[model samples]
Target chain A: MSFPYSEKVMEYFSHPKNVGEIEDADAVATEGSPACGDMVKLYLKINPETKSIEDIKFKSYGCASNIATASIITELSKNKTIEEAKKLTWKKASETLGGLPPAKVHCAVLAVDALRTAIENYEHKMGLLKEKKSTDTNIIEKRLKRVINPLTGLEVLKVNFVKKIDLDDGIITITVNLDSDHPFANNIREEIVERLEPLWDIKKVYVIFNDENERH
Target chain B: MEKRNVYLDNNATTRTDERVVEHMNHYHLNDYAVASSQFSHTPGIKAKDGIEKARQIIAEKISALNNEIVFTSGSAESNNLALKGIALANRAAKRNRIVVSKIEHFSVLDSAKRLGKEGYDIAFVDVDGEGFIDIDHLKNLVNDETLLVSIIHGNHEIGTVQDLHSISEIVHKKGAYFHTDATYSFLQIPVDVKKYGIDLMTVSSDKIHGPKGVGALYVSEDVIIEKITDGGFQEFNLRGGTENVSGIAGFGKACEIFSEEDVERIKYLRNDLYEQFKSGLKGVQLNGSSDFSRRIPNNLNLSFDYIEGESVVLHLDMRGISVITGSACFSRALQASHILLAMGFSHERAHGSIRFSPSKYTLKEDIDYTVHHVKEVVTKLRKLSPLVEQQ
Candidate 1:
């Protein structure tokens, strides 16, 4: 059966691009999955002044796509700046190789993660976090906030540690902010009551804290 | 952009064959009525006809009577039914011990374990380094309380063939039932149900070029089988629910093809490939029985010692040569292969094991290419190993 891969990717893998090692590599990264008997090692050299990749090579230890993905990543990364290299994703690599089936798609993602992680290691050594940033955190925060506290039926605005009642037992009761005047506050109180039902045996836990303890 | 996929995971699950697909499609399209429907019964009648045809063909292949075969989803279901069904059905008599081999598939092993939870005593028969079961040990393990003797016809990991005839005789002498999960080596070998005296046997379609999610259980006419699934009386009130007509028909077609011409032809190709591999490769050790008669024709399990099976398989996959690793990587599934471990191989050797199973469609050139790549890849991967250096 014909597998999804570009002529270039297939050719490079058949006669793998940079088949062996770089004796004195600028950066070398190895990722291993002991379960699947898959291991991948990447070697790269970057012109630190320009931050553009010079030489990129890899040795892959998994499936056909693993080699193709690793080889493609190296070829694609060569001549690209470190900042540009980190932006490389599995979707783009797979798209570059035509495409991978749903199951083998994980192989491409693994290759990309290995490449970016290798680049990150190099950057950490050089003490450089790329100035480029993503807006994902904003969207993620919004999505995570949707998970309301089932106990108090409230949006957990913040969590502050109340003083421990007993050191040996690791027990503490903290105050949670629920809108007292809200119409559903009675329902929220009932919800808290229901939540604490199983935990009721430890009866000392009450929701009250000093105003000074609410500092961020 | 044009892309082609070469799937090598046939042992895991095969691509449904063209003829089987056609048969199934016909049943699903033209014969869409439920087999149980009282009103609008043409489709129902066709479905029943298709099922009966499947059952008859399956029965003939295994040398079983038509009434002896019960349809199931797959080997897992069939195995569970054979083990648990027999146990539960005979529970009233309070016969509650199961004797099985360690080299049996996870389906059989897990089912046995589940039965243990239900207060059944379970004893395991172990295999040697060559994956052969100790028949004497199996004989010693059987006692009066033993309810069933479950052994696999073949080992899935190391391609080990068990002496089913000997096992059957021993179990029968003890007055306990013998069941074999024949899914691994049934179609590959001549499965003489009478010769082995198998009280219960399970066979799956996908393993032998049929559809997945379809299999059959061979119950001897004399062996009283109790129902497992409690519902409608579809499969003679033994296994309940509406029939998968398409799957059953496809399974029947696969069984027919298996019993006819595919057997000798596939075996020839498999032997040729093995001969080429044995001659071409050095430092390669076959894990199971080296004798062709003692093993499955198409399955070649080997421990490359220095090179990891995952590395070899992955390299082959990249080259569009599909193969399977007998061991699981740490980050992969939890089951790394209990069969290989049970066969006295070290953890390192187990992880270095690979299984090469050729189908009826596997051509000579494909095997040659595989051999060539096996030589090259094993050489390359061994260089990355300290074990090779030490050796």
Candidate 2:
């Protein structure tokens, strides 16, 4: 287990700082699907003057990987401009944490996704983007309807598979309730992304399978 | 600091006793002949003597006749044989039905499920909150059409021991056969199939510190139970295979060595550990019967809410303490303890359940260390849990 992750990942996990919520933060974003059992919520206080992230913190509901990555991402984003923070990829998050297991690499992906979501929310709230309602939720819903889940063989909609769908600042986050019994979740995610690919206003698309792992 | 091994999963499998190993080795090296061999060679007679001796001891321990004990691979196969073999034999009787408790082990449950394909109407009896069998429900389920009523003597995960005498009476009133799986309770508790009115019973050697790959099914005299395998006329033409003479010898040695006093001492240790665990821990709820006499003396199952049981088990494992969890994440069970769920526990409680079964070899120090490490693990995981933060 020690070699599965670097000392840095374990360190952040054991002594995770900025581990609470920002009560009245300017921007907030919760990411990760409940189906896979890992979730992270990012809270931010963006200084309007410099358009930089003045304060950042997180609340994570996952294993050591999720907690450490969320803690590291928050620390890495603090004091950085909104645009600069938005540029940080999941790879950079893992690189900063020394390294992460390939399977657990999603923990870092979730961290950066949460950060970008917060940034997107911040820009929309600041009136940088006008009212942000171009995302017709039904288009994604209709696209999801036609998809017959590869494993269950039933239509995804028939099983009540859609867990969550959040639209904020033209950024769409679709959380599908994919149990371990469900197959080809990647294909479902890909189909959803492809269906939304034509929409220019939707800057970012997140199709997450169940994020929660151990306990719901 | 690294911790030494503290194995508390004795119900899963006990460490083979040294005497059992020695007895097995004796048969393997010196008396390595087919037990059923008719040739009058000394080695062949020795093998045959070993098998017969082991069978007599096992039968005596359970208060059965020597010829009644039919040897099989282990309890699972014995369970299948007792259920499917009996069902197959009695299908001509036109009863075409079976009754089993919801808390019966998967071996019995799965066997009954397989029997369902053969047109046997399988009825699951309910259990109370403490995992006790509901007698009224059992009375309602048993009728003229019921061919066999199989109930486990003790629950494995929750450690709930059912009263076989009472259950046997109810099944007998309806003229149906009563089968009890005594795999967990036979050696740890005083299980007398005749005294309890049990028509058939399943017992495992490995669960009682004996060699693996050996078990027995006590078929009451004149039950006329059918055999699944068709081979040489061994095991009185019931279990048709060459006997595992070495393993059976080892099993007999284990049974003889495990005395009545051993039961009392193990029960004392179990209660002592339970007292400390209940007093030492917070938000820890015991899963099975509160009465120690009504549960397996070697088992203590507990649940801690908010945090997953798998987390606690894994953390303890990292500290060199082996245990099992009812958590869906750790088990073949897609979610929570089915035993707990049957007893009407919330999904969270089932997800947070852990079963710790200590043997006679489990030292008081090992129990103390286990409790200390368990508290530490639960506290840490609760802190890390998002569900806790949400609360």
Candidate 3:
């Protein structure tokens, strides 16, 4: 496949802006995923007065797209406020580059992730950052769902509803439905029984609607 | 940047030389004729002469008799013929057992594994961290039931040379036949069948700049081989099929090139490249032994921590420079190398391994260009790595 790298991407990589070390840099962030086989170490110099980025530099160990993404991100953040750079997403980096291979879209994501991670490090060190955002808050709770577990090779019926998690209460009840002759009814019953025993008191466990169990 | 592309992937396959190309072209265009023609015509005479020249050069390179070297498709075929052919002939069904090393190329390993499933017991001797075979472990494994011992000459990945003489002595002590897959080490490292007491040897042409799809097996004059297939009379009534004449011609030229440069000059270039690369990249760890005396100079396998080999290889590829992750045969698979795993490398570190092999044609400028690009790409990639935390 012909990888058409953007001219600016190549320009920054070949003659990178702020390529070397910053002696008095505000923060340095380094992170790598052993699974992905790439690493990013970001160095930033922020103006103490304006809380804006005076310089940004990065060194990356990965593919062509990864190197290009990092180079462009550093160049884009120079002279920009921390909030502006924090707002820059992977989408912005992808659009800046002509495009990347589907497998390599992660390279752009990593570049932005590294920038945000570095900024987070800077904010935490300065004692100005609040608690980091939790990823689960935006998740919409659905009623119930069934899916296959790729790792365990088992069918699991998952309920997305949140019950009152009463640890002090003696007993807790969870309602689920099995109206038809579901093949994995017994399997799901066993799975749920195995999961709930340790956390909650179960004086009597009963399957209210399991026509599938009776038919089988 | 210069437009000239470098090919250091000779271990994958050597480029067909100009002289060999001319010889093949001349035979195909003007002097082409079937070698099976008994009556000597002008075309037949040229074909016969070409085949003889190839055989003679190959024999001389390995110090074997002219009749001992039988041409086959390649090392895979040669190994199959050597191991299976010997086992089927001498070993009883219940007594079938083959001894091999863990670091052997798949041509030997898979061939043994296939036979093992057919009620043949297979014993794989392990290698140390430096890619050296544990002779004592091999000795403990070999017994009277052992049909053959197949050890590779030089490791294709780490480039550590095996002590064939010692290994051959151990197998013979146990009254078992010895075989060495000298595919990667034939021309680069010295080999002597008489000195090592090798009963059977397998080698390929492409590893030494010859045409692909042509190889030879050195079966001892006294050793017996069972026919693996039935066909017309070819390869001394053992492997029966029409021979590849052009590939054989190319193979001969490649052997002659090796004989001409018997003391290889590429070792110095390889060392220079190794030193330059080692000093340029900080936090780089050499995979095998640092002793040049024990390893092949042309092959430098290194691990750059916190970076995946595939990514490093891609960065180098983008710069128009070529290298390898390990053996080219297993390049497509993104798993830890089995050899490295057997030698006790964790999966994470093993996946980060890369091999740098240079041929006689690789220049100083090539190494310089590689070092420059490697530093840049590694520094950049390290930033993105979550495992390699900023200190």
Candidate 4:
């Protein structure tokens, strides 16, 4: 079978750079999870004086695209200042790897999410950022933004699948515009729940699909 | 000669045997007339003879009557025809309930699903951890209302060979027709329809080193089934289309050339490869039945801890090895093997599972090379895996 991976993707997958842990890393963060089919952990050694990333490494438990995307994300962010690294979007990492298949675009998103989380962790460690309340809607929205609609290679929120998000009594109810019988509804629902269920305050996560007639 | 590519994905499709190809060439070039024109001309009679000879060869392999065989495109079409045909034909009998094992191939499972959409009651029986059909669960599912039960004879992914005699007994006790997709275990495992009490069976050519685009469905003479496709009076008027004469001839030749010795050798190679992996690698677990007698000889599925399967498959591909994985990332649907999941394996186990099926053409040297490279690849990938603990 023909794999849709680009030449650059195959190159990075074959010989990924910075593939290990920084034992004395200033910050470390993991995004995605084993249950989600892909997980990436990023380690950052930040230069305290310059606020720049001194070294970066990654370890991945995922497919070729996942490894390749993480490799490129590290390559794009190394030695850059924290503010500059924050601007390193998943699209840029994907472009540097010649672009990923639509189904694999989430791997790029996951890599960028891990890198940004590491940066945020470093900033938090340095007392530069305040600890936001865990139950904030902003946190919910940000997590949902990483929940990709596999069919469109876009976030559920951006695709307008999230018709409504209700948080009450520690239970989060997400209403998606997709029909219950839609081919990808179950997958999207599972991903949404996986994204939200791990919250520090979430007691239960419920994903409701809008009726097919009301989908439009 | 130095070996270049090592192919261990024989369960998917084998390299068409050279002898089978030569046998097919004679029918394609010399006896090119339509088999349906047997009543009108000499070439037509020759074509008809070729078709009948092939039917006899395939039928004899399974110990079924020559007239019971209906040729189709492949296992998928055979399965579709068997499930839909039996269900539709038996509608008047008020037997609207159809049962199938959870681990059946997509063709059978999806056809049952379509039947479900059409208002037929479909029940999926579960399988055990080693991929054996849950006999007790199957007994509970089949009853007077059940029309047919379709289960896979040899699982394609994990290599579990079901006890056909026992499964058939259970289905028949409840007056349901038994059908099995025997694509993987056709000649490698002995199947006697009469002895096993099977009413229908699906067999494919490509899996047995025959030409692609050819397979046969074995229907018992007493079993009534309707044609799903509308066409001319072909395939006992149960399936309609111009016959694939050359492909059928090749399929027959492939069956005729089946050797028990080759199966034994392939089994040995498969076991040897597994033994090498067991000794050479760490964190390796066999996915299917440990007993060789209970599994297809050529198939070996192993799950490596801490690393995902697609990464291992891709790395092997680079080293001229061909294999397949049960990982969601490897499939178009982005779903892990339902069979593995149904067997109660964790998603991690399914994602890490890789299947290696050696054919008669596989050599000991190739297995050695594969094991050597697999060790290196798994070691490298393990190092890069976050799941693996840092030393």
Tell me, by DockQ, which candidate is best: 4
lDDT of each: 0.70, 0.80, 0.69, 0.87
DockQ winner between candidates 2 and 3: 3
Model 1 lDDT vs. the true structure?
Answer: 0.70
Sorted by lDDT (best first), the order is 4, 2, 1, 3
Q: How do the residues B109-145 of candidate 2 rate in per-residue lDDT, one tens digit apiece?
A: 9999999887889999999999999999999999999
Q: DockQ of each model against the real complex? A: 0.09, 0.12, 0.15, 0.30
All-Cα superposition RMSD per candidate: 16.5, 8.4, 12.7, 8.2
Candidate 2 versus the native: TM-score? 0.77
Q: Best-fitting candidate, measured by lDDT?
A: 4
In model 3 chain A, which range of ten residues has the least summed lDDT?
A137-146
Could you tell which candidate, 2 or 3, scores higher by TM-score?
Answer: 2
lDDT tens per residue, model 2, A22-58: 7888887766532334557788999989998999988
Model 1, span B234-321: residue lDDT tens: 7877888888888899999987766536666667866776677678776667788877688876677877755567557756776678
Residue A18, model 3, lDDT: 53
Q: Against the true structure, what is each candidate's TM-score?
A: 0.66, 0.77, 0.69, 0.87
- For model 4, residues A1-216, the per-residue Cα lDDT tens digits are 666899999999999999999998888777765655688988899998999899999999899999999999888999999999999998999999999999999999999988887787676457666554557678889877666553334556788868888899889888877778754466556557655665556777888877743322
Pitting candidate 1 against candidate 4, the one with the higher TM-score is 4
* Native contact share for candidate 4: 0.64
DockQ winner between candidates 1 and 4 = 4
